[model samples]
Every structure is written in C-alpha cells, then in structure tokens.
Target: MSLGDENDGGQTRTRLPDGGTGDVYGGARRPARNSRSLITVVGVVVLLIAAIAFANRSGTGEGTSDDTAKGPGAGAPTSATGVRPVTGKDGTIPTGYAHDEQGAQSAAANYAVALGSDGMFKRDTRHTIVRAVHDPAVVDSLLASLDQAYSGTFLKNVGLNEDGSSPEGLTFVSRTVPVGTKVTGFEGDTATIEVWCTGLVGLAGEGSNKPVTETWFTITQKLKWTQSDWKIQSSSQQEGPTPVNGDNRASTADEIAGAVAGYGGFTYAR
Candidate 1:
C-alpha cells in the first residue's frame, strides 16, 4: 500500500491533490507541474470508474428484480391481515386468534377493547372477561387485584353507581377504539404486543353530570399461545401516543347516548 512520498526541501511532503505542491520549510509554496496534474486527474477518473463497476456488480441486473418484495401496506396507516377474523367467543371476549404474530397482535387489540369496554366496570362481566381472555393460572389473582382497583370510588368518578351501574335515565358509556397494534416481541409460544387506543367514557343523557369524553392510551400485553390460541399472560397500560384534539364540536349528552345505542361495535383483527 505504499504510494511513495515526495521530497520537498529535505522534508517529506505528501503530494497535494489537483496539481498543487508546497514546500513547507518556512511558507513558500509552488504549483505542481502540468504532468503531475494530469496524473492526478487520471487517477481520480480510474477510481471513479472502479467504484461504478463495483456498484454495478453488486446490484441486480437491469431487468431483474425481487418478485417477492412487499408493498407499503405493511406499515400503512390502516392495514388488515386479510385473513378471516376470529368468530369464536368465550362469552363476550373474542377467542381463537391465529397462532402466529398476526394472531398475537389481533388478540392483543381485541383484548384491549374488551378490557376497556363498559362491561369491565360491572363485577359479573369483568369476571367473565378475566376468565375468558386471561390464562387460567392468573385468573383468580387477577380478578382479585382488579376488584380492588375498580373500587366504589373509582366507579363513582367515572359517573357510575356504587355497584358500577348507571343511575335512572342516565347512560354509562365506556368504549375503546384501537388505533393500531404492534408486536414488540415474539417467540415459539410467547409474544408481547402493544395496542394504541382511544377511549370514550362517562355518562351520556339528559342532565348527566358527566359527559362522554375521549382519552388515549396504550396497553402492553404478554401473551401465551395456549389451547391453539393466544391468551393474555400479563398486561399493563400507560397513557398514550396521543394526538392533538380536533376541531369538531362536542356532541350533547343526549346525542352521544343516542349514538351509542344506535351503533354497534365491530370485531377487530389484524
């Protein structure tokens, strides 16, 4: 790798680029000869040619391509697995997700919606959901912890009765809409997923003290593939990757309650 060195005034001088030479004894410089300048130019052209040739060799043929390359749908704003959604349900919780990454993602998304629904406020429905979606080994402990967490004070704060029911002529509303899901980890039988969601909660009716309001959050769940499907092993939630509020006018309580009664929720899948 020796390119040789130039001698200038008894001191070694590295050749300057582009026909420039300098004798740095005390600061007197001279331009290089035309022949040396031509040599430098030729060397630069050779290097460029070599680089281009190497790049061409490493690339695909002009007409050849990766036929299996996927498109942007994989990371698009709204995407689907294109597989049929799960139809099976254990009580109200969706079940029988696929045994792969997509399945894990679907299970997590659906579980987030279920856990954030109005049903979870009530003791009976909460128990049913816990048993259906969670692993059997953790169900009892999870139920006990959840019961303590959803105390009477918490229920009243959300405009629910002491028993997690709505008062007469008032409607209790809690709904979660998953914005997206991501599978952060996956292995043979275990997976971790995070679901980003927007939720609506509070009372909606005439003279209601609490009007329906929206919030954003993310739920992360560790899942185990059991019984040919994904079941939640453990889960934790945190406040969201929330977006700024939009300019839409707020709906009246009666309108919100009417919409909730009129519309039905969808079963989500990846």
Candidate 2:
C-alpha cells in the first residue's frame, strides 16, 4: 500500500497520509438544524420503500434473481474447505497456492489483504511483501519506486515520522478487510481477479487531527502461476461500491486504538 500504482501516479488509498486534516467525513461540522424533522421524513420514506420492495418481490417470478449483483460475501462459508489452508509461506506471505481457479482466487485475496495492511508502511515488511507477492520481473523496480513514494515528505503528509513510524503518543491504524473476490478472467496459467475491500486508515489518539476513518475500494490483480504459486504481474485499484454512512455512534480514539490492539487481524483465505 505504501507503493502507489506504477500504471497511474495517484496516491495509494491505504497509504495516503492524512495530515491532521480532521475528520474528512465532516465529523467536526455540525448540522445547521436538528435532525428530528429529517428523521421523521426518513421514517416515512423507509415504510414506503419497504412497501415497494415487497410489491416488486411479489411480482417477480422468484424471490431472487440471478441477474442481481453479487454483494460482499468474502467471509461467508460457501461450504467447508476440504483441503487444508496453505502451510507454506514465502517470508510472511502464503505460498504454494494451488494451481487452479480456487488457488488463484485464494492468492489474490490474501495479497490484497497484505498490501492494504498497515505493515506496508514499514521498510522491511514492505520489501518482504513486494518480493513475495509481486512477480519476480517487477519486484526490483517496485521496491525502488515504493521506497521513493514512502519518502520523508510523503510520511509527513500522512502524519507519520520521517521513517514511517507513528509519533510517540499516537497509535497509527491501517487495515484492509476483503469483502469478496471473483475472477474476471482466467486461463490455465494466468488469472485476473477483483477483490472488494473495506479499509481503515489514520491515527487513533485523543485530540488526533486524523481520526480513524474508513473507505471502500476494489483491487484488481493480474496473477501468473509462477513457481507453483500465484504472483501478481500487475495490479490497479479504483474507488468502490461504497455504501452510505450509517448513524452509528463514533467511538473515542482510545476505544478505537484499544480494540485494534486487542483484536488481531486474520490471514485471509478464500
């Protein structure tokens, strides 16, 4: 994530620094009027919406349609995995992916998770990830470019130390949660997959200018079956099918940081 895409020179979504700009979501901005009236209007709208949905379903041949979009289902248990998860790893990345569709999907999903993680900000882990997940042909160039992208200026822009470390009193947070992955194109030796993801980025601490925030995105990876496992030949990303924000109570910085530290991240597999 520290490395912006070579194909396009824009900032990487997960790695972009949020230099204490406050909540990008307008968190500090107050509504001009009380939302009680808006809530009443929304309540009426919900009932009408529910009625319309029920009528549409009743008119349809079945309760569902195959043409409907496949929403996020990455964590759903389609069935049980008869085969065991990969036991082999190249550095910290899973390796020895099966040479099949399922294996390719598994590889792509896990790679997205790794590349979008907070660890990508650090030098050593970033190198390990690039070496392990990227095709050997592009690994060296990627390392050099990524090193430049994560320069002191970029780190300062995102509220990190010159060396990409968090400040002494703050906890930096970056995480990627894959919602689902599907193959867009595939051949015996090559595959292209899209991984839908939701991510958290920013710092969590009292009076933090950049409060932990969330964003949605999709990553497309072109993978090749090399060395008996899938390796990314190239990858790109775009903004996503982001849902509207909900009315959930925002947690305090200490609460957010504690939850992150206490709850460990998963090593994703499809």
Candidate 3:
C-alpha cells in the first residue's frame, strides 16, 4: 500500500507476511537490524574522521606542523603582515615605507587615502597633499590639475564655500578608506599599485540638498622611488567593485556630522 494511504480512523497501516520475516518484495529475508545500524554508524564515523582530517590540514588542529598546514596560498586578501606600520609621517600622511613590495603597496594605499580626503577639496591642504605625495617632477602639474578640478564652481555645487568650507550648520564629508592593495608591477625603482577604496562625500545637514553618500572605486598609482620614499608619478581612478547596500537604517545628518568630527582617519599600511 502507498505510504500516504490512511485507514478510516486516520491511522496508517502496512500489510506484512504472517511471520513478519519477509522483505516487502516477498520471500527474501531482510538484513539484520544490527547490521544496518552498524553500517550507518560506520558511515557517520567515516564522515567525522574526514572532517577532522580536513580541519587538521587547514591548521586548526593541535600537533599539525605549521609549515605543511599553512602556506602562502592560505592567506586572505586582507591578511596582516605583522610588520609594524611606518613610523615616519609627512604632516599627517604616513611615510618611510620599506624599499620593497610591501613598502610600495603601503605608500600607494596611503596616497590614495590622502588624495581622496576632504583636504583635496581645499586649496592649501590640497597643495600640501599633492606636493607631499607626488614626485617633484609631477608636483607642479598635479597641483595645477587639482586646483582646476576643485574650482569655486565645483565647491559651490557641492555645498561648500569658495574656500572649501561647509556652510553654517553643515558638514562636508569626503573620506576614502582603502579596502585592499595590490602591486601590479614592481621593478627596481618603480611600482604600479592598485588600491580598492570606498569613499564618503557630500554635505551633511538638515535641509541639505546633497546628503552624504558612499562610492566605491579603485585607484591605480604609478609610483617612483625617490628621496628615500615612494612617491606618486601618476594616478587614475575608476568606479567600483561596488557591493550591495545593507539593510541598516540611515542616520540623521547631525549624526553623520558628529561622527565625522569624532572619528579620525587612519594612516594605512600593508
């Protein structure tokens, strides 16, 4: 009988031979219950053992050899190097990267941060940042380019004063956080690095037309080793590897402004 069929009293019933000793197919003896149970137990034990072996191979188990258990391939994109961050600073930007791949990546990341900062919206700080992070050969041209980009018209459109200051009771937010860095090319004195970044930019205040918003972009920096540090020779940015927005509630303008004022930016490193 079909398993779904029920008797009149709403109970299911199955027909069996008089002795209850035959298989459903009739006349064949069924395997012993203990044998079936044993098979199931063995299957479960095998799976458990496999899981344990995998865990140990991945370096999570005691007595696993460090060398075989974890290789360079095991590291995540955001893995830490355990090396201390550069101690030197030019103004607020980190400086004195090691003359190696790690140093080049660190300089590129920090440069991306400085260039995407609110300071770049203002003239004097913008100049300071440009000069500090760029090669001397490119500094003048870069300054001119940046000045034109942050012109009064651009500033006004973004709800900033001619001097790049926010209007009364408003806060202009522009900040870039580096998500990761990769060195695409590294020669003796030059390196090309790409920094994946997410940034915030807009005017935050009640009744403001330009509410603070987020953007994702990657900045590719061609760096030159000069003056005992890595400096940007040229750079370009392109939008996103953007992620979908989460279901968090948007905060008030006041909260955004307060947070900006309270939290300081970091000096990024590899």
The candidate maximizing lDDT is 2
Per-residue lDDT tens digits for candidate 1, residues 1-270, read: 011111111111111123122211121222222224221211211110010000000021233323211321222234444345667788766677767666677777777667666777788988887777777876776677567756797566555788989989877776677677666777769877666666665666776655555555666667888877788776655555677666555666567778989987654534
Evaluation by TM-score, superior candidate among 1 and 2: 2
User: In model 1, which runs have C-alpha deviations exceeding 4 angstroms?
Assistant: 1-77
How does model 3 score by TM-score?
Answer: 0.70
The best-first sequence of candidates by TM-score reads 2, 3, 1
User: What residue runs in model 2 are displaced by over 4 Å at the alpha carbon?
Assistant: 1-82
Task: Give the TM-score comparing model 1 with the true structure, all chains together.
Answer: 0.69
Q: Look at candidate 1 and tell me the lDDT of residue 11.
A: 15
Which pairs of residues have clashing backbones in candidate 1? 81-270
Query: Tens digit of lDDT per residue, candidate 2, span 111-140?
Result: 766776667778888788778887898788
Error of 2 at 87 (Å): 1.3
How far is 39's C-alpha from truth in model 3 (Å)? 67
Q: RMSD, each candidate, Å?
A: 27.5, 12.5, 26.4
Q: Give model 2's clash tally.
A: 1
| Candidate 1 Cα deviation (angstroms), residue 236 | 1.7
Question: Positional deviation of 151 in candidate 2, in angstroms?
Answer: 0.5
